[model samples]
Structure formats: C-alpha cells, structure tokens
Target: MPVKIYHDEDTDITIVQSKVVSFIGYGNQGRAQALNLRDSGVNNIVIGNIDDDYAKQAREDGFSPVSIEEAARQGDILMLLIPDEDQQTVWNEKIRGNIKPNSTLVVASGYNVAFNLLTIPDDMDVVMVAPRMIGAGVRDRYVQHIPYPCFVSVEKDPSGTALATCLSIASAIGATRGNGAVGSSCREEAGIDLFAEQALWPEIMAIFREGFNVLREAGFSEEAILFDMYLSKEPAEIFERAADEGFVKQLKYHSRTSQYGQLSTMNRHDGKDIREKFHHILHDNILSGKFAEKWSNTKWAAEELAKEWKEVENAPIVQADERVRDVIKPDRKK
Candidate 1:
C-alpha cells in the first residue's frame, strides 16, 4: 500500500493566517514571499524592517511595517527569509531576544540552523517551508496560476502543530496551485535546497566563462560567439524546444534531421573544444578549502562573478551588439 500521509486544502488556513506573522529581511526571497503571503489574505502580517524600501512596499501592499523588535514582539510566527550568512546575526541581535517563549520560528533555508549558526530555544517551534525556485520564477509562477512546489519540515514541534501550521501557510502562498507537491522535514528541506543552489550556478558560470575564453583565444570575437549562443541560433533553437514542450517533449519536437544537425554542431564546436575543465574547476573550488574560506570571509562570490560578467558586457562590440538587438526588438516581437 502507498504511504498515507497528512495534507490537503481542507487543512486549516486560518490557523496561520490568524497568527501575527512577521517576515524579517527584504531581499529577493523576502520581497516576493512577503508580498505573496499578503496577497493570499494573510492580513495579520508584519514585515521586520524600519526604513527599508520593502517596509514601504509592504505597507503599501497592506502589511504592518514595524521595527525588528516590534515585529518579533507582535509576531507569534516569525519567518526568517534573510540570506544564509546574515541569519545568525539577525537571530542573535533582533529575533532571539524579543520572541515570545512559545512562538514559531520559520526558515526557508537551513544553512544557519543546520550549520549550528543559530540555535533555537527548546521551547519554541522550528520549521521550514522552502519554495523550490528563485524569486522571479516564484513570482511569475504564482501570477500564472501555477503554484510552485515547496518542502515543509518541522524539526522541533513543541506544540505538535508546527507541521499543520506550515502546510496551512504553504496553502496560503499558492503552494498548491498546479501540481503542488509539499514534502516534510527541516534538515531534508534545507540540505536539498542548499545543495541544488550551491551546485547549479557555479557549474553553469564556470562552463560559460570557459567557453567564452576558449572561443576568444581561438580568435573569434566574443561578441559574435555570445550573439550566436544567446540570440541567433543556439538560444533560439533551445527556446523553441523548451517553449513547444517539456524536456522529454523537446526531444520529440526535434526531427531526426534536427538531431543530426545537433550531433554535427556538437562534433564541430562543443565536443571538440569543451572538456572537463569546468567540472574540474568546480571540484577544485569545493574541495580545496577555497570555497570554505571565501564563504567564511566577508566576500560575495556572486557579486565578484557579476563584475567579471560586466567586464565582458562592457566590451565595445558587445555594447554595439546589444544596441543593435534592441533596435530590432519590434521586428523580433512581430
């Protein structure tokens, strides 16, 4: 027999919606999540920030905006959607001191709690409800009447109502719209989210950077190469495949002739030139203690990568190419 677990729409919404929910932080995850939660009729919500733009935005969107202390005091359910690194400090300074003894502390990711950066009081409820996508995708998917899947985990449920409350909150924020699947556990949810995030972006960036460098060293214009990759042929074809169908369906969309063309292109460009360097780099960075040291320091790897990207973006030919593309946007749309 299949495992019969507990969850459904009839599960109480007012349980969480009635609680004074305070969201701390106002970045990518924070902004989208706070607004989405409010839009779902979670009216007893407070955003923890004094003068931040998200506070302003939250107020405009019909949420109570308060200082972190006041938010913590007023909030029976405190959601920590801040960045991984900053969570500990925030918890120590703002949240831990002010929270009601038996209140709930919700985290979307598990870094601080998993790594023992933030230790919860034994009396409080600790749970996690993590959406499986980034901010834009999460927002867009919700707007499209497609609720993204979420992982709900209850680590320490003193009241035994943590799981139910989390599921209720999930339902409130469109987590059950189109094929919505919600799974259980704090450790499991945190681990999976962090692992996927840590692996995918660096791997893709390393691949792109190496490919761009190799093409440039081979005397091809980086602008020409990226244009072909992004706009002209490669991206267009990929977009066509993805838009027509899902990943498996994409293979069906490609004719045998198209398959042969792909094989030919791979042989000519990708197979011949691209090797295991990106994988090697990824392994080295992760294993060589470099990634750890960088993380432990006050460094932002994504920002640094963005600067390198901006350098490539600032190349004169690249600028001109972008301008030309913009000029033809109307034609492309037509």
Candidate 2:
C-alpha cells in the first residue's frame, strides 16, 4: 500500500485555525512554527516560554509571551518545541498535570514520545509534526510557498479526529506546500534521526580523518588539504545540488572524469556489512529503547560524553584542522 501523504488539499486548515494553540519554548523551531501558524491565519495562538531572551524576542514579534503553566492551561492544543534533552524536565516541572485534559499534545520531534520518557494522559491526543528541515528552512519554504518536507503522525487519537488535526498543523506550517507531508510514526522518526546522528556521521568523520592522515603522510600541506576536503564548501554545494536535483541526476554537474571515476569505483564497495551494522544500531539501540535507557542515566551519560569529547579534541585530525583554520580563517571566532 502507498504511504499516506497529506497536502493542503487533504487538510482542512480551518480545524487548527479555530483551536487555541499554545507553543511552549519560543526558540528555534518553536518561534518559526508559531509565526507560520499565525501567518496562516491560525489566530488563536499563544507563545509560552520562561521570562528569558526568547520571550523578549517573542514580544518583539508581536506576541504576548506567557508562562508555560499559563499557556498549558489555556490551549486546546499544546506544541512542545523545547529541545529533546529538556522536554522531560520541563514536562515534569511545568507541563505534566498543568496541560488541560483532553487537549491535544504536539511535538516537533519523536525522541521523548518514542522512548516513553514523558507519560501522557489517556484522555489526550498526541501527535508529531516533525520538519525534515531546520526551523529556518521551514519558515523560508513556507514564505516562498514551496512545500517543505515534514514527517507527521498521530500516536494516540482519543478524540478520533487527531489525524485530521495533525494534518491541519502540518498544512499551516507549510509542510504540505511542494510535495506533501510524509505520514510517519514517532518510532520511525526517532530511529531515522538518531541513526543519522549516531551511525552515519561517525562513519563520515572517520573517513575524513583517515583521508586527512593519508594525505598528511604523503607530505600534503595541512591548509591545502583542509580547504580541498571541506573548508571550500565543495561538499556542501554537492549536497545542496543533491537535494535540489535527484542524487544520481546531480552527477551531471560534475566533470565526466569525476563522474566516471565515482561510478566505476562505487561497485567495489558493496556496503553489505555496513547495512548490517546500521540495522543492528537501529534495532538494538534506537528502536529497541536501549539508547534511551542508557541516556536516561543523565549523570553517567554526561561523564562518558565528557571523556569522549576530550579524546575528540585531542585527535590528530582535529588538531591539524585547528592549525589550518588559524591560517586561513584568522578572523574566525575562537
């Protein structure tokens, strides 16, 4: 069966427009989403945050920012846009019992919900409207009337209309603009997000570091190699083209020799072992709740992370990269 994709045509935007939506944490994704919702004519909206700089920014943006407790009490829909690390703490301290019973709970990420870090009430509807892009891109695409990508799902639909409400939010946020929002679950969202952070980036970093080492051993200039590898933003341009065009289709922009070299050498690496390793990480750690459980030990996790970061700072590649930055990026911030 084809996965359900929600579009502006599929969603009744009026459903969300009529509801009182309170956005908790007026920063990052929170502010972008709230502004988009308001511009989409969702008039009954509130911004919730601590009395901080973010709240000040909200006020400057024509919103009357209120306390999290007050916002939780008033809204028919509560969107949790705080960082994943802080969600559980904020929920327990401010939102847990304060959130109105039977009101909808919305999250931009699936981390806490997928791992059951926050216990939700049975009477309420819980859903996710996770943007595939960053907050800035979400707002930018919406403003440009280009449909930005998002993963939306309703976890608990006690109200029976939760799916409709979820789609409505997605539409208002400009997620249904270009193509449509992909219907996905909290677990799937969490698994894929974490897999990229844990599985993919680590391997990428390894490849870069090893390549740097080989070039350095061959008497290449550190500054020259650093620029060639990443600092020149060549890979960033390639990735941008990959997103704008099809991944394979974007290869046409490269020199024929470059394309031929890449395509020919690609067959030598089958990636079967890499696929198996990725599957293990997905199922054994993220999907099976092992990583969440391990991370729940905040003190232990922080200690281990500190040690690992110390090693990262001490790594040869990072040290060389730092020296190269000092030469080429003299005005760069420390």
User: Mind giving the per-residue lDDT tens digits that candidate 1 earns over 1-334?
Assistant: 5322334553577888788888887667777777677777787877888587777776776766788888888888888887776676677888888888789988887656555567688888887777877866767776677756677667778998887887777777667565554566655555555445566654665666667667878899755766765656775676668765764457556689987887677557853233464444445654443454455333575677678788878654466556667665747646
Best by lDDT: 2
TM-score each candidate: 0.74, 0.93
Model 1: worst 10 consecutive residues (lDDT sum):
1-10
Write down the TM-score for model 2. Answer: 0.93
Q: Could you tell me which residue pairs clash in candidate 1?
A: 153-185
Q: Which regions in candidate 2 have their CA more than 4 angstroms from the true location?
A: 297-306
In order, the Cα lDDT scores of the candidates are 0.70, 0.91
Assess candidate 1 and give its lDDT.
0.70
